[model samples]
Target: MSEFKRAITAEDITRLQVYSDPQFTPDGDAYTYVSTAINDKNEYESHLFYKKLNGSDATPWTFGNVKNSNAQFSPDGKKVVFQSTRSGLPQLWVLNTDGGEAKQLTFFKNGAVSPAWSKDGKYIIFNASLDHDDDVESQKEQSKEERQKQNEEKKKQPLVINRLKYKSDAKGFHDNKRNQLILFDVENEKFTQLTSADTDHGYQDISPDGNFVLFTANLNDDADYELINDLFTLNLKTKDITKLTDGKGGYHSASFSPSGDKIACLGHEFAYKGATLSELYVFDIATGERTCLSEKWDMQLGDLMIGDTRLGQSTTGPVWSKEEDRLFFIATDFGATGLYQVTLNSDLEVLYKDDNHVFGFSYDPHSDSFILGISTPTNPCNFYQLRKTSELVRLTNANAKYLEEVHVEEPETLTITADDDQEIQGWLLRPYGFEEGKKYPFVLEIHGGPHAMYGQTFFHELQLLAAKGYVVLYTNPRGSHGYGQSFVDACRSDYGGGDYTDLMSAVDYVLENYSFIDENRLGVTGGSYGGFMTNWIISHTNRFKAAVTQRSISNWLSFYGVSDIGFFFTKWEHGLNLLDDPAKLWDFSPLKYAENVETPLLILHGEQDFRCPVEQGEQLFITLKHMRKQVEFVRFPGSNHELSRSGKPEMRIERLNHICRWFEEYL
Candidate 1:
């Protein structure tokens, strides 16, 4: 056995560095990525890092702890353009690889994001939200005193709500500003507005010949009532926009082939209600022939895997191979993500498979290698290199030193039989300092996104529980990704039935196989969807001694109107809207069965959480209190739905402390 170190603590999470968004230069000789670390103010700051393909040491390309991302190299590989917040607002900046400082490129009022380079390297396209009648340079010169006066006046005025989608958890309250595509000429430094529509347009890719730009937008009059985004191609010469995908489903991540003959995209037609998996599709530009390449693959063709408070977005890309006849993308399977390649003939082959989450990756056709950002159960994410010959190389060790000083447990994978005779996948994590024949209190950790999977990723909350001398177990039940569409769709409408049995079966299997787990001292906890399951578990049985639910949904009936996405999410998940069948909504609500609860429960919620509003937690607390059951509620002020993963550092630490305290008091 290795030398024993200290158990992992919540404070350790702050010291670790997160790596994401690896992109190789056009020439494939070097690559750049984003490395984020929490500053002294407890805010995340990302910097750009660069490395050469010859296995050279990595170094910071852009200094300062400011936010820098979306680094893309020009065709000649001499200049690199990226988005940065150094000037207070995020804007485009360019830096020369050989030498020189990064120069600011855009001065738009709302700033810019998702920058894409033209093939000729003379133009850079970006997305920015702007008011319909604002002049770019004129708005930039607005007096600071005048702006403050307007802000003060607006604060004193009443807030008049009119839009259907008024509030969002991530971006906050809605402004009338809409995101639109804009083109910038690198030589003249001119910003041109390409398309102006009431709806938003996101930049995707530039055609190979540099004559067309690909994007996605929803121009429907009632777009707020539906969830649909169609693909489109705009000609730069004539300024003509061509619709690619039919308005039947949602689509994103559209990429053009090298020959400009085909386009690869990732989306679904909402086939199996809200639980349908995203499938990859190929579009023939000439014939308008659309083909679903991954219709029968069963696995979700995008990154739905979640973990620690990593800063950058977790997005999947369908990059075209050098031959232009094949596409490379990532898919979730079981508890990990696998990179696969599909030929035009529909021959799918797994190129890289592992029991870890591949958060982001970039391919270099020149070297036939991939720069991968990966995370394991014991390690936070870092960069690695995978060659065509199947050779693996570790490129970055951002968390190696910290890991050496801590005791991290690698979970053991297990397969248990569900009540329906189906197989359930789970992992059992022993305490940091494990001893044979020593029984310990067990904790079953459930994941949210009954649609999302519990993967072999580094989950801090579960690790903290294990560090505190508890045997932690988590699983991907029938209603999770990576196991196929049918399994994920199975948990819908029957919230607490088969899914609950699958979890119990996992606990039973672990107790029967691992003699060190004390069956009598079992506890359970989860957040979001997991929170809902936690509530359902307590109501359905008294086997668990204690439980903690975070940002949970107690009543589907109320969730329909309260949650930001609840109106449609309720209909999509339950297959029935609130008005269509209120009784059905109540049938799955945990609040309806709170009277039967016997276990001591702890409810943790974020006050500003609109996804599963704190009201959900309040309703459950009130119900349990009315029933005279043992329950405690902890509300985090000024926090949102993503409080656990990306909330303020102090709040997250307090949350962990609350859970540990609750468990210690009861368990």
Candidate 2:
């Protein structure tokens, strides 16, 4: 280690840059990606950056504090279309690649997003929200102040509830607006409404010959109670709609082949309810036949690795080759995400596999190469070019300066056998400044999702703990993804049972093998599911000196009704609803055993969090306080369950500091 290097701090989050959505130009000469970072105002700023294939420095194409992302080049590679918030709301904007001012392309009322150019480059397809009773043409005539007045009037009236799914964590209560498709004619400079259905639609991909558009939507009458999303195609000339997938299964991330004869997607039929592993599927356009390509593969498709450092969205699902015989996609297995290739005959091959996280990638069929967005434990993100004949070439070093000044610790992987003979994977990190024989306090970090995996990604919270002189440990338990199907489904219907044992087994394994960790000075913390485990661990035993729970569920009885996904998620996970078996739900709750807690605990929650809901934290805090136990509660204003991941920048830093402060004071 160099003497000039310094330990990382919670505030260093502002200096870290995140990269995503790498796209190569049609000519394959230059590529563009989105780079995000925190500004002085404590807000996120993202911009599009462009670079050539000849090892040139990347330059920013857009300026200012506004977010610019999802850049797609035209077929001829002359112009780039992207989504931007510079117009107050997210809208479509176009910029000439040959150097000129960017032009705002859409003036829709609710804003247009996810712009995809047609094959001929004469039209652009996007999605926007529209009310059932509202006319698209009339919305353009209405001024911003007029819309504000109308919204104020609507707010004065009481909200009438009629649907089961009325609220969500991302968007609060449901409104009358339903997302619909819109087509923009570049040559005519006019807007045309494509589909005016009452249901929301997702824009997937445009056909190669420009005759059809692929989308996903549920038009069933029982859509309010159903969870299935079926793929559909809209004919441009006839304005006709055709269903592609069977109504029994849910599908998404669909894209047409080079010849437009087939469509590839990632989906499942809910074989294990919500725990089903996604499989690759191909549909014959002419015969309406769907075939499962990866039926024998037992891994989840897409980037399931969870981390707090990633900012922008990335490309997932299947990307076709020039010959159209092979397809490329990202899949999760063990603890890391890797890029893999599959053929129509069900042959699979690993294209890239390592201990790093492949968050995004852009494939160029013409050159048979890819621009990959990868992250490691020490690096937030960087772009790399991969070729069939050459080794991985580093394209952009976005965090080179930060890495040079800070010292980050790499973790040692561990495999522990559980009480049931099941193997659990974990990682251990020594304190920033450690001596060979000196003992240090240990902190056990648990990841949320009970379905998401903690892999080789840059986690700011865990790094900060290691920097604070605490030996940090994180693991993938029974319920985490990246493992096989049975492992992910093992935690369901028995929350706090096998999953709890797996975590405790990991701690025991570390303590028995690692002599430098002090057994007496131990701390634990987790968010969401991990938060639930923290509460469960402290109540079940007093081995830990301190604990912190974030956005956790303590009472399942109340959680069944309060959370946005409470009603259905309860049945899907616990295998029973509140009305089905109240006793079982209450028995699995952490609050039921709150009287046995002996360790000091800290409770943190977001006021606006609707996923787990703030009430979940409030219930546990009130119960612990009434029991005269050692507990404290901290509430973040205008935050949600994603406070640790994509919450407000300032709030995220405060959350990290609070976690470190609590552990430091007690441990």
Candidate 3:
């Protein structure tokens, strides 16, 4: 080992770099990706970077403080198109590989994103939100004065709430606009509106021949109340549309097979409602026959599991192989996310498996290799190359230097059998410079989603706690993914029942096996579902000395009506609507038993959060204060539910500092 390094601190999180959206070139000789880092202004800036396949050093392709991402090479590999905010709004910019400045492609009013190149490379298609009644040209023709006048008149008008779904978490109110496909003719510089539907169209992929485009949309009359994502293909020549998937389940992330006769996507048929594991499905374009590729795998496809440090990267391309007989994708199994492959012949295999998280990857059929964006407990994020021989090559050392100067304790894995015979997966991190036979303070960190798993990913908060001479323990209880569908659905309606016992069982197991943990000085903290659990734990037990609940839900009754997805999520998870049984919702609520809380509790919440509204925290805080219990509520001014992961940099650091201060005071 090198010389003893300093303990990791909250400020170090701002220095961490996040890498994502790796896209391989057509010839498989080079690849482009986005590297995001916090700048001096405390803002995250993403830039484009690339490296050659022949062991060449990575070079920056784009430079700036603005964010640039979703880069993909043209079919001819002569030009690269990406979305960037360099022009004040996210717009398409194409850069020639051999040289000069990148040219702006679109000036759409709502901006453009997710650029997809056509097979012939003559057209670039992208998605942009547009007003339902106005065309792009008409909107552009309006003067600034006229637009300001219309906005003022609209503000004076009464707010009409017509749609069942009106408000979103990050987005305040749902505008009467839709995301439609826009085709940009590269040679002529012409923009054409493809679809004029009221429903939002989610872009999938274009056909190999470039004659058709596949997309997902819920175009039903009752789309607001129903969860139905149907696949449709729009013909380029005839301008005709064809529906591919039946209204059976929610399907998305569709990709066209190389031969254009089949489409594979990830979706669930509401088998277990919101907790249903996403399975891979192949739909035959010629016969309309659909096959479930991962019916027997018993694993959740894609990366729904959450980590504290970084936001989740999208799982890309069910990337069909050259022959189009097999497909490659990512799956979360046990406690790690790995690349997996499944064939039409029912053959399934794990291509890459390790105790690390594979956020995204791009496969090149010509080279039979993959460019992966992966992370581990110690590393923030980096790019790597994986060959058929299972050999791994590091492509970027984005955080290697800073990491070498800091100490990140490795967590030991554990599998504890719960009281009801379910095995709970967990990990325990020892304090930095841990001494043998010395007892240390312990903190139980819970994860959100209750449906989200806590696994082999880099978590900054946990590391900071461990660096502060505290043993950090985290686990995936009954409602977590990575374990099978049945285990994930176990805690659906039993919020604090078996799942609570499962978490308690983990703590008990760790205390029994690790004698260095000071059980009496234990602390508990989590956000969202984890926050809900933290609240639930303190109300039910006095074992913890201090607790921090962030962006958490204290009352299910209020969550059913106030949350962004409350209307549907409540019914899906609890099997009860607000009108069905209010008493039952209250029974599972954490606030119902808040009067029993005896631990020193700290509540952290984002003021503008809409998922678990700030009101959830306010209600809990007021209840505790009224009861004369030890409590403190800290509110972040302009953050949403994702405050912990993607909030403003300065605010994120302050949130971390508050967490540490609260624990230091009582633990």
**Candidate with the larger TM-score of 2 and 3:** 2
Models 1 onward score TM values of 0.97, 0.98, 0.97
* lDDT tens digits by residue: candidate 1, 1-667: 2246788888876888888888888888778888888888787788998888677888787777589998988889899999998876788899998878999887677778888889899999999888998665454623457557777987898778887688888876777899988888889878888889888898889999989999998878888877889999999999999998778898999999989889999988888867988888899998999999886687888777867656786446798889887888888988899788898888999888899988777989988888888889988888778898988898877788888888888999998998779999999999878888898998999988889888888888888999898999999987888898889999887788899999999988988999999888899999999999999999999999999999999999999988888988888788899999999899999999999899999999999998999999999999999889999999999899998888888899899999999888888
Clashing pairs in 2: none
Per-residue CA lDDT of model 3 for 18-78, tens digit only, reads 8888888888888887778889888888888888877788888888788888887899999
List the candidate 3 regions with Cα displacement exceeding 4 Å: 1-3, 138-158, 311-315
The digit string of per-residue lDDT tens for model 2 on 414-488 reads: 999999999999999999888889999999999988899998989888888999999999999999998899999
lDDT of each: 0.87, 0.90, 0.87
Query: Which of 1 and 2 is the better model by TM-score?
Result: 2
Off by over 4 Å in 2: 141-156
Give the local distance difference test score of model 2.
Answer: 0.90
Q: What is the C-alpha RMSD of each candidate to the true structure, in Å?
A: 1.7, 1.4, 2.0
Q: Which candidate's TM-score is highest?
A: 2
Using lDDT as the measure, name the better of candidate 2 and candidate 3. 2
